[model samples]
Target: MFDDATPVIRRRSPKSQRRRDGLIQFAHDFTSQNGEDGILRHIFEAVLPPNENGIRHCVDVGAWDGRHLSNTFSLLVGPKHESITIAHDQHNDGSWIGHHDSRSIWRGVLIEADPGKFRELQSLHEPLGNTCLNVAVSSNAVSESSLASILQKSTVQQTLPLDFDFLCIDVDGADYWLLHDVLTNTSYRPKVICIEFNPTMPNDLVYIPPCNDNLRHGASLAALVELAEMHNYLLVETTIYNAFFLPKHLYEQCFQDLVPDTSIEALHETTMVTSLYQLYDGTLKLWGCKKLLWHRLPIEEERFQMLPPSQRNFPFAPNITSTTTEISDPVVDISAYCQSQVTEPLHSRRECSSQLLEQLKSHGFALVHGTGISAQLCRDALRMTHLFLQEADESVRRSCMSIRDRARRGYSPINTENFASLIGEQGPNDLVRKFRIGSESSTESSLLQPNIWPAPSEHWDEETCDEFRSVVEAYYDAICIAANSIVQCICDGLLQEDEGLAASLDFLSSSNSQQSSNQRNGIPTTGLAHKTSILTLLGYQTGSRHTKKHHKKKRAVHPLVAAHTDVGVITVLLYDSGDCAVLQRQVSNSESDKGKFKDVVLPYPVPDDPIFVVNIADCLSALSHDTLPSTIHRVVPAEGSIPRNCLALFVGFDPDQELKLKEGKTVSYETWRKDRIAESQKVLRNRMSVSKS
Candidate 1:
């Protein structure tokens, strides 16, 4: 607080810096505070002087319940907290009880604008003898006076000292303004400050005052840095939401040993121990500071070990070098690369209830031994697929061609070799009919959209169309039923605790109250209609006897579908084709980050032992934070003249709800879906323009 001179940080060699960064990435010593609550521990441990004990004092603005997602929790009561302690017969919280003797002593003042949350916050810190205020905080003179008065009263009443050790400001609105006022008008200066930073704001160092509650509300990173400098603080670490800063004096003294030099070169370079981890349903985040040493715990060490050797290598070099032992007859074990983490699929739904939960956690996808999905129904569905593409009249097939803006829906025949190589045979041979099933509105309140049933054609026999509709619809319903169970299995896997599951289900149910029962149910249905789940009928024509074989036979012989990950949560593949391949990434030390793809044959579904192959997709991986692997798979051209017919179902999250992550970061499914669609359209437009030229 007394220092006017810039702090000097210790300088380390490049090799030493790299080694220190590696240790932090491997150890999980401190968890992510902004993303979870681990990063705060790193911040506190780094700034506070060694051997200093007992509450230095902290103030948390916009403190909700003082525990869940709180940045000051680690400093207030210590990290390892238990509700029930046998040694100390204390009230629920072990604040003044069992572990208080060895506890890192600390006290805090929690302020929340919401009356209800403030009450809960008070109850949570009741045993700690900390003050919890329910009044709103603002930069206005009246609000500033009231806030100053509260601080004055707390200091006198509790006989606590002034000049807080830590300050956490995180009100949803006017966060920047209130923080600015505190720095400029108050005599209090926190040794360390953890405040919310707006990610949506432009990175340029401009300060935008909050006037509308609807807009993203927080100070920009550059703006916060400027503000902290004005208050004699040095910006230390920037997490997903919060920015950590240290008083200049504290920075020069306590942090020099851990933090690297703050020179221009060190500031611009990303030599800090940074990490990108997906919080539970949260946005992917980068963690750690360049200057501060990043500490890793045992759990993170185990996580690194689980990675392929290439990823596990130190220095994180793109081209990693490793020695290999050659085998007499090398045979790539496909199972080793893409098989379920578990040994076997569940035999029944009951088994799915018990075992699939563990499998989803480990493998991300599982095979059900007995799904009860009728093989005959699937065959009939395949027959309908064949009739729509090959047997149907020319006008009937043309009628289903997608219109101007609805390319994702209706019928689309493969035209280019790229399309053919990705999902079907080259040329206009492959026909796909995409049907949306459920409610029509794709808003936050309603994720369901009415199904766009294919119109009956006059050229086709009316009786045959009716029969086709009946059979296909029945099969669709059956797939939904099985998929629902799969969805439940995923929910169980993703949300292990009952409370987490209940909260998710409650959100889903409340969001779709006006929609059908299926909509209310937490099912994976997204990526198409930007909300509605998709059911596609794939008809890949290898060739027929009457078809011309001369011009380009290479198109048919090449990989029918190129390697790609599914866009949705999970994909249910139902087909009798033996000519498909699952593309599993094979990482080599010599290869770049994106490893080469290895293809393995996808076996045909046995008639007697009918099994539907379900693969975890991109949406689920994002939702699950990569806990489940999103299987990358593709179809290969059939060997015979008969066309390969298959049905695929893509399920995802409800569009209306935003993925609530730690540190107030959120991602809207609908927004992400729209962006993906826009990107795809741009690619298609460029491809079409090139072809026309």
Candidate 2:
């Protein structure tokens, strides 16, 4: 029934209609996007009535030519008078004061650092009752060009109110620092602040690049929000690149209805979707701008990555795609992977394949069996550990006592360690004697202390002590080799899975190589040396003095080693025990099985083939974004069981290697390790005090 030439009318919704009406009433564009100029005009009209005789002051840093992309230019020129040209002589000093004009009530200070731009700014603002400064504003209070110093040089300094009406900062670089200084050091607290922010950054990312005069790296909106809150300001609105903040008291009085939601997410949601993201394979995806706007460098570099290359894989991607769609690959069942047996020969590096990587990713452990580390070598190490513990006299034990402040590289007597306290559980002290060893020669000898070996005594001869030291050193070297091979295999597997990860890893490796070379050349590097990794020989003596003390307390079970996660990258454990002594906590969905500890069974060694159990430790788990879990395990012997011995090589990154955790905190490996150790010790001390009470 409709005519062929009839035009269809589209009805606007109530919300859209209101927006349209608003635009018609207040959409004046004076070099500002998103109607910022009109908004500011309305705000000023409401707060500072033009009818009053009071003179309102404004400050504009980085005011280019005083008009182009200027926030205060419209306010200076006023809404009524469109054309008014007047020539005025410049003052002898670098400052120019304009004649009073009846058309405008705002008196502003326009500052531009560039010499050429300052000339244009003076020519434009000198006739409009405004002050123009040619000096750059410094955030440092001590600097000669500081805002306070510069303001003192101007004629308007006497008239400028402590609580100024408006302040606009668009210096691009050091905007945050400048504002912070203005609020903290000086008495001036502007009623409204219009600051520039990097629109390309994510809403949650709180990044403030180092302040440099030559660099124009802008601060993030989130950082500005935090700074505003610190100074009793509430974020009211945001354009694409600028955020508007109002004093909390003023906002509460008049602007509550205007901005119902003052949160950054509500105001700038569209601009907050970051261009950078990560794929399931640890591949970074640059969705929008690939280059840094100010630095003119590619953002795909390793330094800009949210997480380290080793941690970018699935389940570890801090910023992933927004969609809920799964990857094309089949989903891996964690339970099946936990139960799967991944075994490789220690001698053959090629056998450490994807299967082992998968098992490590799921179950956090794998087994290496072969002639690379002969059965005889393991037996000899275990025998020496037992002999050293049993034969060492009190004097020898005291001489080798561990220096708690340094790298614990000596002897720790029985009943000294209570690892279960780390997980908030109180258990009997471990009935174990430990001897730790590190590289004999180290560049930083103070940090990595020298190993202390038992000298010739009544229990052992000089020749026997020499043989024991030789066996321990040989075992340490062999385990280090196996650990290096396993790490290389893991890196190779990750590279194979995702080629993007290889580039980042390569970049990191090249950086580390350069740092290592610098250290070798005595360049005074800050990173820790690679020789700081430790090897611990654990001897669980049955019916010992510590065990007797524990038995007298009538505990249900004898815990040789309490439940705790290892502190390094990976632990290569070689134990001489027929029974299943190590128990690992198997996390399950079933309510009844939850938190239960399951036995970790080791395969019987055949002839010359010795087996090494490799488990993921805390550092690797953190670096890998928990794609590999740090397995929580403990050593507890069965009733009527004989003594057991274990030689565990705890491999770690160079002490100086800095790691960024998932929560966006960066800390050195050594510091991280020391903190964990300190926490464990504190808990142990607390538990010990409680037990004594």
**Top candidate (lDDT):** 2
Clashes of each: 29, 1
lDDT of model number 1: 0.52
Find the number of clashing residue pairs for candidate 2.
1
TM for every model, in the order presented, reads 0.39, 0.43
lDDT of 2 by residue, 572-661 (tens): 877654232444545422466545676654432222445567788887676665667777777776543334567888877666767777
The numbered model that scores best in TM-score is 2
Q: What would the per-residue lDDT of candidate 1 be over residues 187-288, giving only the tens digit for each residue?
A: 777777878766545444466566444454556667777877888888665555666677888787867665555331232223333444643322243445
